[model samples]
Target: MKYQVMHDSGPRLRVRAGQWAFTKEEGYGLASLLLDQDFIHDVFTSYRNGSILIYYDGEVENKQRIFDILDGITIDDLFEAEPTQTQVSKEITDDFYWNISGMIGRRLLGKWFLPMPIRNAITLYRAIKYIWNGLDSLTSFRVDVALLDGAAVTGALLQGQYDPASSMMFLLSISDELEHYTVQKAKSTLKDSLALNIDTVWLVDDDGEEKQVPAMDIDKGDRIKVRMGDVVPVDGKVVDGEGMVNEASMTGEPLAVHKTNGKTVHAGTVMEEGNIVVEVYSMNKETRLNKIIDLIENSEDLKAETQGKAERLADSIVPYSFLATALTYLITRNASKALSVLMVDFSCAIKLTTPLSVISAMREASDNRMMVKGGKFLEHYANADTIVFDKTGTLTNATPKVVDVIPMSRRYKRDEILRMAACIEEHFAHSIATSIVNQAAEEGLKHDEDHSEVEYIVAHGIVTEYDGKRAVIGSRHFLFDDEKIKLTKTQEKKIEKEATEHSVVYLAIDGKLEGLICIDDPVREEAKYVIEELKSLGIENVIMLTGDGESGAKAGAKSLGITQYRSQVLPEDKSRIVEELKAEGKTVIMVGDGINDSPALAAADVSVSMKHSSDIAREVADISLLSDDLYDLVTLRKLSVGMLDKINTNYRNILVFNGSLLVLGVMGLIQPATSSMLHNLSTMIFGAMSTKSVLSDRDISNDIEVEAIQVADAS
Candidate 1:
């Protein structure tokens, strides 16, 4: 682990351990290890130079900790090396540079050293492949870019112009290489942003007691518990228990795999049913399940609809280009002029630039803390006219506050009821549960483990065993209608009078009403402004749906300037409403953050999940905002719209510029070689332009800063 300081700045440091200090895999391992530190923001490591450059928090203690961690690295750490997404991107980039250099070297050396006959033979051999591809397209009854390219090269060869023919083929080869490199680089960039953040897991002790602990605290050989609806936190083998685990994240198959004792389970897969205790095999950088290239490959199938249309249009224009070439040859009786006309068709630029635009936009979205699954979702979001929002977590601030606690039964005190609720609720992700836990903490109430085997009923409530009683806490529907818990007239009246406007959580123990907790969810300060901005951006209908009472929903809608809303809606009702909106010919966008929101998410044209969304909701959503700010939604809208605009602009420019080229070529103002070279150069230029970001930093920030200042002043 001996190393020397190469460079040092306030927040950036470079250290080297000499050549061959670690292999390429170990460099990835070192980078992953450094990145896991809370103080480190980014890291770059090179095995050849044996250098690690670290970007980190500027605090004094953080700097010291980085050095200490580096000093402590052991040879054993290298054995557990695994490649990170950053490493994958670096590998692809290196390969691209090397391959491009090698291609150029071969082209130049072949030209300078090889005699005329050998060079001609090589050009003719390459021309045969292009000609065969054109024949294949003809056999399929489709004239495409391949046929046009083939015709251009064949004309040059027939005219005994081997140098021009070879040059054209070389340029085409370079274009194909560039396209492949762009696609692979885009996938690598996207894969880095899709990593799952598992903060905590249930660790099982040697005595078989299960306790929740941070995921980072566990290492190889630790046993952990995985339950229904929970994501497996590490790659491991099941020591005991059984479950149906969903391997969709690892394998694209939709079905869950049945895993029992001695069977293998992977990190990032979710347990759909049953429970299992897993013996940890690998953690962090060594986990095999992190290789998710298949998922990235699958995203190619989710191309934007506009991109598909552009590709089809490019092909459809190919036949017309052939007709133009034939007409020119018949009228002028000049083979060279006809060949020049054929060289300037409009497919290459159209096909290359559209996808590059989408991929670049996606990368920009990722840089702004948003994970977009595919380009089609961006197109859908851009075209969406109506948007539906869930009440608690979407419109209002998700941090609800506990206002009051009323005891229904004389046996339990208010503090006792509050403590009990927090004890069971701490494990759940609902806003109400967080409010109760925060309230208990503020009141200095310590809620230790007093419950056993808590069961979560999605959208309804929680059921658990508390103090030798069946304790149930949730919505009124869950306690009264579903569980058949009776509420006396007097108690009902007391609750109605006390919790008139606030949302109430009913708590029942041993089939008796024990207490009621009142929660008040305040509206987000920026909600009204975001709504106004969305309207300005062409979002016509803004609607809110909630499970709260009508009065609460009405007030929330009024405060947010939303004219349409639905109250007391169940999960199924939310889905039905979205479907009804679609039936009305509106492209709908649904925003939600709970397991109950999954159905509505699937029903909408495009769905977005908040930063703190549940696992199921994130799984169903097309886009997930990693930042907590609601304004990121506005940013997403602008990005999607900007992407569409760029695509259209590219299309228009391609048609006009290529058309001018065609006219000049047919007029005999340019040679066939010049026409071919100019056409390929334009395609490369358009592609390079498409990769530029759609929205500049100033474009995204200026409006946000102004609106935020205005909102603050008004408040």
Candidate 2:
């Protein structure tokens, strides 16, 4: 099909043939023909040499090569060499000489010189640049890289508008990984997350009633409430609520978590709380719980962690290629060996393997409900030595239910106190409010739509009158600072226990502390397996970082066997911690599900976030797990390590394969056909290797590094 040149910058032209985009080979080929027929023809005719040679002649390849030989020499120098008396009469060189000489005058000396030869030269130059640029992107220090955008890749395949050689290399490489056994295993992650039924949504009713469903709408450090019938919104420690929760979705355990104000809970767990308010601290995906799920599911990442040696080697190859060619000729005094060195120095295997491993690992991770956005992070994940975890979302669930309600004043009945708090909290959509309202409902109290005029306070407390007695429910700090309410000893103890065991909600009636409610967020059962797997994968240190109170954080950490812990840590602290680890020469991989974790994730060697991760976290994370299962972490590490191994092997093979050709060429043992076949075969082999990234090993065996996640129910 005829394709037109759609774009041109000097000699670099982009032509679209049907749906394909062409750059070097096909593009250069077409441009060369145009240059010769139009521009070269004009110059030849202008020079009065058009009748001497034909432009479409099949002998152009040899003609161009000969032109290169006499590149700087004038027409007279060619004939100056003395010819034997017998050479002119019957020799092949003699016959070829005049024909070439005349052709040079007609084609080489005119516009054809720049249009045909120079065009092909520039195309070759562009091809080499594209390859080098791709390699640069894989290094620690980012280099300018151009992508064969979807438009480019698709266009080339459909319209045949691309350089056939370059396109074939990339697409064929993709095909190779697809055919490999291990690469196929990684490819299965995409479907698993979608199949797990972990998606969370908000229950907004037309009647103005809204319920919070776990797995969605998770803001970092925001309180979320789960009712007796609903799912937990995110991963968090129980802080001021008591409830029974079913966590089979995450932990594969049937036992319920009797979570009360200090335990962690996972998303997708069913709530069995009697009554409680669960403060939300990490609904990172904006939907409340999807962020945690997204983190656990993405077992793959695109970050590459090539050592200094690999990087230096990648950078040195180009110069080394020229050096090898020069030294071969110097040592052997043979053009064949030097040519072999130069021609076989493409660096395909070394360049392709690193990215291929990342790609395959990412796919494998997704099979276990992990989604990785790129191959770059997958490389980095394998190198992580220290993993900083967020306690609330990382180790605990976000489903806090109302467990206990204590009345300080004898004038108020326990049920009346609960109903008043629930009535006033109806306007708020927070987790605490849900616990109160649901608690009131379970007692079969018919809610009164008529509410006495109540004032909505900001971050302090709510104020209103109940049963003609002034009543309010708010945090201790808010009441003391905003409303001038002092706490009694008994109330202080209640608040202390709430803060220590779990998150708490403070209730005050008529300007004094009334009582406290404790909530719990239990550890996810899958977390244990995930941790064990990571340890098995060779990660010796597991640290928990949380903004929650120390006792609450430690309580949950101990239940899960994590001794290294940091509580009450802010977002800035998280970032600083990662930097400190990196400074200590530790390769840190951070797994988090909140916006607060974005900076830390960006700062770490590699960061893997959940699909429900906050926008900022997702933006910075190298791998995105669309599913909410920690088991995916194990698959990611395994696939990544395995993939890298394959890549290294391929790199060594390329060196040996190409190096052997130079030796054979020097000994005069290799023919043109044999050398050409090897060269072509290497390209196919490299492509096939890249395809292996997709066709990963299907075994979810003992080899992979799975995160030790402990899924538990807080009931």
Best model per lDDT: 1
Off by over 4 Å in 1: 1-81, 98-132, 135-142, 162-167, 193-223, 227-229, 234-275, 278-300, 407-429, 444-453, 464-470, 488-494, 509-514, 710-712
Per-residue lDDT tens digits for candidate 1, residues 543-575, read 999988777778788988999999878888998
Deviation in Å, model 2, residue 382 alpha carbon: 2.2
Off by over 4 Å in 2: 1-315, 363-368, 424-436, 446-485, 494-500, 509-511, 568-585, 594-605, 611-622, 693-715
TM-score of each: 0.84, 0.53
TM-score of 2: 0.53
Model 2 alpha-carbon miss at residue 185, Å:
19
lDDT of 2 by residue, 1-715 (tens): 3334344343233333342333223333332333333323211101111111123233545444323432433323322222222222222333344554664464334344566456444435445655554455545344221222221223222332223333333333333333343333333332233222435544433353447554434455555555555556566666555877655445434344678887777655666333345555554343323544355445443235552334345545655655766887799887655554544544444555554555555655655566664455666776677777876556655445777776766777778777777888887654557777888899876568445766644334577876676777775555666678787787667567545677556677777777665556677666766776688887878988876566777787888788788876766788888889889898888988764565577677777776555443554566776666666677777767776777677677777887787678566687423443465467556645654643335445422333221112332
Q: What lDDT score is found at residue 182 in candidate 1?
A: 75
lDDT of the structure predicted as candidate 2: 0.55
